[model samples]
Target: MRDRIKTDELLSTSDLRVSTAATAWRHVEAEYVDEIDGILATLAPSGPYAYTVSPRMEEGKEIPTQRIVTTFDEIAETYQNLHRFAAVVAIRPVTQLHASWYTFVSGLGRGREKATGQESERPVIVLFPTMGSEGITGELFWGRTQRDSMPGDPADGSLASRFAVAKVHDTLLDAYRSGDVDALTDLAHAEIQAGLRDYEADTGTLAEMHTREELRRHLERFFGRYRVLGIDVVTSHYDDWFFFHELRWTVESRTGDDAGQTYRYHTAEYAELSAEGKIVAHIGHGTDRISAACPGPA
Candidate 1:
């Protein structure tokens, strides 16, 4: 991804297949170069949100993880300071487990070393949510920065260690990829519903499914339109409340003007589980189409 992006252009899609929260985040990053005021407008004025950094090891000593509670003003100020020496080179919106929030992975470029001119990048995971009346009055921010050298979570008694949440996720994807409605039904909460509000689109326009049946029908239509070739999980983390993952997959159009063509997409997703371990909600924050090819063999 480029260091700078034109978000306004991407938000013009006539439908709500994409995410508003993710798009809003991209807008914030894109405006950092020219509109500090715009950045402020998108965030909540005050906050007690948690911001954590992944732990790293150096010289055989661990740089223990750290966290803080901060406000939007502090965040904005930090962004201003960073503008002097860094740029947001890439953004990958991850799926979120909460309806009001979103999460994403970002790459910060700190420019070349003064002497060696060697470039370096930092990876950051941000969790942000909008709150208040109309779900638009303000926004809250929280994040965890994962350094390039940070090690994976150590074995512990966390929920991830006690439950096979990642396996549940894998099964969910397998169900979808194989068009197994029975498996999909078994995995979802009865009242399961999902959506993304497209504030940029015409008012009253929404992309949502209100019940398990609705979700089923929607997937049936989708499966009819595209043949899912395969899905590969790139990375994932599971906790008590959410299962976060990154995936890359390819598909071929089944019946359409583009039939027979193949397309590949990379996405980040979040899933919420019910007490019975079924998925209560699943949100897709964003998807980036990485490539497309001409008609290919089945």
Candidate 2:
């Protein structure tokens, strides 16, 4: 029931166009385009977005040449290696979605947050999609993708509770960005549970502090490590018990062996708030983008 969005009218299938005239390609192209139009009609009709088609690429021919492909399964296989996907063909967008060509690329992946589309400071709902076993099936296989960063409808939680934690979030975010260690320390309760620093590795505790001074010491080094910075709130959720976030940010090292390095990192945080609105238990986790050398001007 949740997946079924109510729309007054379905987007016209004839409105979409594919570059290829091949019957084989048309079969799959129509399917993909229709799915997108359904999504737009319900969630973002006339919204900013893009759709692109890329043909299979070959060697020893012109720099930009399309090779013949018989089935849609080929596209699924190539999606595994992103470079190979690009090499397969150029990505262009449906002209109506975006006014400028550049915006289309940004929406596709050139510079997306890999989480929720909303900007900073908005409370996000934690929702995932569920499908039935009755849709047309195929050999299509796409490896797990963070590309579907946009969440579905909001999960179960009251807005009042979310706002309660958001107040603290705003303060913590502001303090961290401004490098105000004292203010950050004051925002937390005397006791803390620094969650796994590397959530993926699942190592030991990030930091377990019983006093504000201890948190302050940790904050000093943590906050001082970065110079120029950027933050984007991808998807977020409040499940009645805790407020959580999946986010990405840009940072340049300031002091340490890796001092000059720049990183675009993905992180998540789960915070437990007390009656007084101070963060009592905080779990922080994230990993740096090794491939993203240094974030530059956008």
Candidate 3:
């Protein structure tokens, strides 16, 4: 059987680079740069560029791993070669604008169908921008087109509100990535609490606690055990509240029999956010498997 490695043993500078590249590849494919450029001509005059990291795959594994180094470099070269005039943007995940567009559309449809009687007949449409599109005109143009395509209804205002919530979600993720623990604590609502509770439970811990001190202590301990090698926001959704696409760090104990091994794990978390963009509750689910890597000491 293959070895089950711990995260701490394997996250090196090379690992970080590979992970970043792989994520960039995913963004390039999903956005379809060709189509994005066409859309940008209308909404943004500046050119846009994007790339994704190529996920790593084992020699005999059925499914490919998320170590996409090759893909990232390839996409970067492709962008530079094809769009000479447009600034070849550095590879990154889909922008907050894209996330807001997705959340708004998904929630709008669900909300319209849920209203009862007259309210049911009168659906709402919302328009919200999570980020300014100075770099990616194509994304901005596509976003506007998608927003305008929504059916006209009274709930338009409500859709706008949903966009506001998405903005909050994006902001919170940014703060968390920047290591702003205090900012994260202040922004977290029930959804974030719920998400952390789910994380604690999955890792085998206690119940939900509201105090910032408790959370800080818990996070400190967690980080000590497993360093945060990387974080990627893959997708997001908002119903009455907001949800996030979070990729976090996981590590294994290095003492005892299982020593000197490393692995990478992926997780998907659903969260409920407050009006101010704090996470109140969250549920996480995903497969926990060891990733392939070079042999090394723990």
Candidate 4:
């Protein structure tokens, strides 16, 4: 039988300190010590690895010690030290791994601090899966962790994927807000069709708004009546065939007569997209609730 594993499980936690060490090595050659030093500074405050040492002295001689005076100075000194030890660097990879692991551990630490209402440290290390080990790697790690711990689905979806979706949503919202009808059309999917049908029915304009032109005209008229202040996403979820969002909109009437009337509305939008991320359908629930006021006719 094939080994059964749930994809939602987090695999191995990354060591942020090790990850930082690896990052430092990757960019060590350049004058980007300031940047590398920033990475190191994130490791646990007051930890042993926080200091920088000079290159090893001659054999049987006391190793010369150099306290890293300034943050930039420390980075410069550490870079030189790394160069000197480059030949005998057996556990460099281990350093990187530890850095990566520390990242995760550090984040957990922060969460704990927040729960207890502790002051947050600057340059706090936080763990995030590297590009290579994100979705699948995290799933595997979580799966293994679950095997030893309690049972439950690990967080579904990779952080990168979720961030990508967020970007997509943001881009679409920008298009909509800017009245970039073409861009909006490009991003729309089948969900838009379903949404339009509902809108037409609810607004009692079913027969009049049939074609894309008619729909665009109607939207222009409707949206033209309001100045959108913001569109905030409330939630997003997806299954095999569809993705949807719960969105909140803040808008003020554009009509001179209703100039001061601002509204906050909730919408439930469903989207269907093409393989390239173009939206094919955009469907939703929109209810306008008065939220603010500007000077206008009652």
Runs of candidate 3 with Cα error greater than 4 angstroms are 1-158, 190-192, 195-207, 246-262, 289-298
Model 1 alpha-carbon miss at residue 127, Å: 5.5
Q: What TM-score, over all chains together, does every model reach?
A: 0.47, 0.42, 0.37, 0.38
| Candidate 1 weakest ten by summed lDDT | 197-206
TM-score between candidate 2 and the true structure: 0.42
Candidate 3 per-residue C-alpha lDDT over 1-298 given as tens digits, one digit per residue, 9 for 90 to 100: 1233444534553454344333323334433443444423323222222112222345864222221111223444544443443322222222232231111121211111112212221122221111233222111011011112212234557676566656666776666545556776666442133213222224321233334465566565544444343455555564445444535433443344444344455444444444444554443333343643523322
Which model scores highest in TM-score?
1
Encode model 4's per-residue lDDT on 69-176: one tens digit a residue.
223445446645554333211111111122232112111111112234343211111122222221101100000000111111235344433344455677877875
Assess each prediction's global lDDT (C-alpha) against the native: 0.48, 0.40, 0.36, 0.38
Identify the runs in model 4 with alpha carbons over 4 angstroms from their true place: 1-166, 189-192, 196-211, 238-241, 293-298
Tens-digit per-residue lDDT, 129-224, candidate 2:
011111111111111111112122255234555666676777777776677888888887665433324312223123334445767876776666
Candidate scoring better on TM-score of 1 and 2: 1
Give per-residue CA lDDT, model 1, range 192-272, as digits (tens): 544322211212212345457866776666677778777777667765444666666677777757677777765555555
Best by lDDT: 1
**Who is ahead in lDDT, 1 or 2?**
1
For candidate 3, the 10 contiguous residues with the lowest summed lDDT are: 137-146
